[model samples]
Target: MKKLLTLSAIAASFVAPAMAAEEVNVYSYRQPFLVEPMFNEFTKETGIKVNVKFAKKGLAEKLQQEGEYSPADVVLTTDISRLAELTDKDVVQAVDSEVINANVPAQYRDKENEWFALTLRTRNVYSSRDRVGKLGNDFDYIDLANAEYKGKICTRSGKHPYNVSLVSSMIAHHGEAETKEWLEGVKANLARKPQGNDRAQVKAISEGLCDLSLGNSYYLGKMVNDKEQKAWADAVYINFPNQNTTGTHVNVSGMAMAKYSPNKDNALKLMEFLTGDKAQQMYAEVNYEYPVKEGVKRSELVASWGDFKADKISLDEIAEYHGAAIKLLDEVKFDL
Candidate 1:
């Protein structure tokens, strides 16, 4: 993926000079299918050609390496940790557009405006329908440590960004010492060594490997739509943990402006467009992600899952404890 992104970026450079003057270059961690529709619509509306280089990882380092000569006008990424990485690495600059400010809530964006969230997803607990059934509203994330569920829980790697952010939120609410013990307790209850993606954990539940698992909310929507995965999706009921306490841990897919963007006007326009009604609506319909924009309606399938009260804690605060969360995961030997 790294080599491919590099070669694609280089290929983009040769083609860039011949492209229309009204163009913006995008370095996206988002998959092309998810973002292309919005980009196409943006071009249709503004006459600005959108050039994208998509990769799963290494975009931040690539931007830093390119320095002032980087053709990347904007960067798109999923997870607050990735958004924090861009700001921490100094590869992105603050976007002060009034349109973006109005579109995204303060809790979902950087305090200094370096990054802005476009969509929201929760870190949910999935309970096996035949065994555990839907968990009660009183259930909390900390409850994953309870002995009653021992030998019945499954999850992905603790170091994965989704779980790390959840652990970070735990640290935020419980302090590191308590959160470490919580991690230790949760590890003790694992159905097997932590492995696989969120959907894989759901599959494990379907196969009766575990009675409960941790996963992102959108994966349920995706699984429901997939022919082979629907049975996995059917085997469990998604429950938003910590409903009565801190609220469920929510993460975001977001965007930032490259520090040395050559086409500032077009880049800002794209950013603003992403926050507008059209793009927000597209995100909900195409990706099944909750739109960060307040007034936009969720997709019918997403809305069917019912509304959740997302953790009110600022994502910036959660990003602060990300390293601590990873350290806790290691300290607990969570995947061992």
Candidate 2:
């Protein structure tokens, strides 16, 4: 009976860990198709089930309202502005994982360790290959505001989060007064009313409606890979601006640990695991983005575009000045 009791205890101990690995809930802005494969792979490897709630808007407000009662263990979003908004609202907790710290570069992660970038995308300018005759070798955001480019440039609405962040970064570097002036200059240069997403702006360039427009680096990759999009992608030359100065203006799709997470340990494990080699590679290849992990190779599409400098500014700063940037954009009447 003694030996049987001992054996039973050993069996129970082994079973406990399996039972402990329950499910983790995630709130993500990324579409389900974009992330489900990764989630499936994670479950197969770790035996942890994932439940995700996805929406294009208002996930932040939902998390904020739920407060401590929120069942969400992790929050994922694209772009620095939204991630920073979550940090400001205190919806996320500061995490200090050595794996995350080592994998994500300083510029890409929150200064306080509240969030970490999983992948990077550059905000670049695309110009018709034939019209530009080899787009300027080095251009920065400031260059777009140059008087020469006025009435020749095109972009999406300034209210767009991506453009707002770009304007915000300009404020960080040039101060509000100068940034506002730059906004006016960019506005004056608009070929037509700012309309459409980044991809649409590239389409405009391809159609000869505009000479140049602002776009995200990865969108070009997506275009290049698709038969219909290939012509637009092939028609333009992508210019990584600010390489000689602040490097390229880059943004990220990142993740954070929810403050009210019931499964904190598992959440941290998932965070660290996502920042690891396997997950980083998956993110980069699937999205055509630059990996946050140092030394990870960019997608062949990204690599073919050539290397450039990336801004070393902390992304949180860009988020912090977002309101001011928006105000400046409004003052300049950046209709696009």
Per-candidate TM-scores read 0.94, 0.92
What is the C-alpha local distance difference test score of each model? 0.95, 0.86
lDDT per residue, candidate 1, 125-198, as tens digits?
99999998889889999999999989999999999999999999999999999999999999999999999999
Error of 2 at 155 (Å): 1.0
Q: What is the C-alpha RMSD of each candidate to the true structure, in Å?
A: 7.3, 4.1
| Model 2 poorest ten-residue lDDT run | 131-140
Candidate of highest TM-score: 1
lDDT of prediction 2: 0.86
Model 2 Cα lDDT, one tens digit per residue, 1-336: 999999999999999987776888999998897778788878888878889999898878898899999999999998888898888789999998888898888878889999989888888988888888456556678878788776778788888888888888888888999988888888888889998899898888888888889988989988988899999888899888887787778889999999999988878888888888888788778888888898877778788889888888888788889999888877777883
Superposed model 1: Cα runs more than 4 Å off: 1-20
Q: Give the distance in Å from residue 133's predicted Cα in candidate 1 to where it truly belongs.
A: 0.8
Best by lDDT: 1
RMSD of 2: 4.1
